[model samples]
Target chain A: MFQGRIIDTKLRKLSIQDAEKFIASSDFGASIFFSGTVRNQNDNKSVIGITYDTHDALVIQSFEEIYNEANEKLEIKNKAVFIDHAKGYLNLGEISIIIAVATKHREEAYKLSRYIIEEIKKRSPIWKKEHYQNSESNWLKGNPLVNEKN
Target chain B: MKVKIELFGATRDFSDQNILELSLNNDSTIEDARIEIIKYLKKNFDGNKDFVRIVNTSAFSSENNNIVSDNYKIKNNEKIAIIPPIGGG
Candidate 1:
């Protein structure tokens, strides 16, 4: 099973407990959870907050694509995967993303968790704008999207 | 003919709106739309070269949410989106 969603701050907050609950199961012996937090500093500047913008429909599509790719590449068929990302301004030390995986062993769980996050960063149409302490903010340059079919 | 493009991420600050409208000739391709967007960005945000670079590197996704190539024909009132570089965890 795979679950991916964007947590809109206006509606709800992204939480670890929800991710844990989604992937909890007696069928798996290992559960790996990864949470990406907004830190205080970036490029030596004080990061007061970050606002994450996403193309909602395309993002959901990318999530499903990533999950399917992980399934094929890792060869781990029976598993539970939960991914939730925040879609609004997050203060320092706030959780921006959570990737939880439950599999039959620790190795697949760890590999799947890492693989999904990396692929999401590369493929998903999500952007981050960092607000500094002095009231200045800038959008961080990210990996350019390249379509192989183009 | 005209096309409406939904802006996201860094482009949001440039236009100050989520959607941008561009006028084009008949049967204009996605490449033409890209050029028009670059012109609009340059004309409005003249001093900012960074945003222009974003336009150059961006991809256009059709209403169906699939990335279309530069040669894809543009239809009147077709809603598309300019997807800039992405970075998420």
Candidate 2:
């Protein structure tokens, strides 16, 4: 079983606890959780916060595709996956994303966790705007989608 | 033909609008649309080459959720999305 969702900060926060519980099962012996937090600095600049914007529908689509790809590539049939990303402004140290996975073995759990995050970074239609200390902000440059092979 | 382009990321912030409407000749392709959009951005932003460069790297997607190539023809009143670079964890 797997689930993917975009968490709107205005409505509610992204909870690691929920993800942990969602991926927990008696049958799975290994569980892994990964969380991305808004850092206080980047590229020699002091960051106050970050605002994440997303193409809501497309982002979900990408998440589902990533999950399916992981299932196929990892060859792990029995698994539980939970993924949630924050939408809206987040302060430093706040969680931006969480990925939870449960599998029958530690190796599968670790590989699946790593694969999901890397794929999401390269594929998801989400953007980040960093707020700096001097009341300035800029949308960060990301992996180009235009040159993708059709 | 007229089509609506939904902006995202830097494009949306630079344009300050979620959607931008454009008029094109009949049966224009995505390449034509990309050129027109870049022209608009260049003119409005007073030759901000950096922004223009970013928009040039963007890809357009049809409402059916496919990243279309420049050769894909546009239909009248079609709603397309400008997908800029993606960075999510």
Candidate 3:
């Protein structure tokens, strides 16, 4: 299964709790939960914060598509993919994205989890804007994984 | 034909609006539309070459939504988006 949400608030403790609850409730043999947090530095710069922006109509399909592709390519059966991405400003060390996956096998869970994160990086049309303590800002460069094939 | 291109992320800053209204020839493709947008950005916004990318309806929704190629034709009234690099996790 594929599940996703575009969260407008910072996610941290609550997101972890929710992920734990979700996997525990399932009968999967192994599971992984990944969180992408905003760090205080980027390329040696003291970053104060960052904000994520995305079109509401966009990338929702990207999430589902990535999960489905992972299921088929990884040969994993009976799996669940959950993704929650923040939509607005996030301070340093805040959780910007959370991903959880449950699968019938440990290896499959690990592989699928990595694949999902990479795919989200490549395919999702979500944008990040970084703010510096000096008030300079710029959009970081990103590329979709599928774009590499083109 | 004409299409309304939505601006997202850094593209919004370049266009100064959430949406960009541009016109194309009767059978213009996505690439053609992109050319027009780039031109507008260059002329009016001093846009540099390496800054924008296009994510069509296919970014999530359909098999038909291939990342636009030079010959990728566009349908009339289709919603196309001009976006900067996405930073989502």
Candidate 4:
């Protein structure tokens, strides 16, 4: 099972409990989940919140590629992958994203979980805007990842 | 030929609209499309060239989703995307 979504709304943060329930029925023995929350500070400034944005069609395509590519490298089998990204705005300490991977073995489960999140960050057509405590919000870099890294 | 340019993240915010359309010469290359889009961004959308990039949507469906160059030729009714540096996790 592969589930990937961009939840674009002004609602409250998502719950990791829901993600665990979604993974509950997995027949695989090993499961690892990762959740990213909004931080209170970044790069020396106080970060109040962040607004995430995405183009869904391309986002979905990127997630599929991440899953397939990870499997090719990691021998992923009987696996379930799910990733949900929060769009709109999120407050500090709010759940911004969730990633859960289930596999027949613990190693593959852990490895794929990391790979999936990294790929989504690296390839997914998603963007973020950081709202500071006192200053105007600043838009973070967009989808051309490597150029920004270099 | 006409091409639709989609914007996401900061690009969408800068442009205000998620999609922009351009009509180009039939023989226009991707380079032409890019110049036209950038011109529109500066003129109408208050967009800054230094903060933006052109991403070929066609290349995304291939094995590698690398951004294509301006030398690539444009197709009729093709849709391209104007992307900024991605910050999502």
Error of 1 at A36 (Å): 0.5
Residue-level lDDT tens digits of model 2 in A48-123: 9999999888888998888888757889889899999999999999999999999999999999999999989988
Which DockQ value does candidate 1 get?
A: 0.63
TM-scores, all models, native as reference: 0.96, 0.96, 0.83, 0.82
Candidate 4 ranges beyond 4 A from true positions: A142-150, B41-49, B52-78
Write the residue-wise lDDT of candidate 4 on A1-150 in tens digits: 788877765755576776777777648899888999999888898999998887677788888888887756877756888888888888888888899888888988889998888878877777888999897898775456433210
| TM-score for candidate 4 | 0.82
lDDT of 3: 0.71
Between candidates 1 and 4, which one is better according to DockQ? Answer: 1
Runs in model 1 lying further than 4 Å from the true structure: A147-150
Off by over 4 Å in 2: A148-150
RMSD of each: 2.0, 1.9, 3.9, 4.0
The candidate 2 chain A region of ten consecutive residues with least summed lDDT is A141-150
Model 2 vs. true fold: TM: 0.96
Candidate 1 chain A has its poorest 10 consecutive residues by lDDT at A141-150
Q: Give the clashing pairs for model 1.
A: none
lDDT of 1 by residue, B1-89 (tens): 98999998888876766899999999999889988887887788883788778887888899999988889998899999988888987
lDDT of 1 by residue, A1-150 (tens): 989999987778788999888988999999998999999999999999999998988998999998888768889888899989889899898888999999999999889888999999998999999999999999998887854221
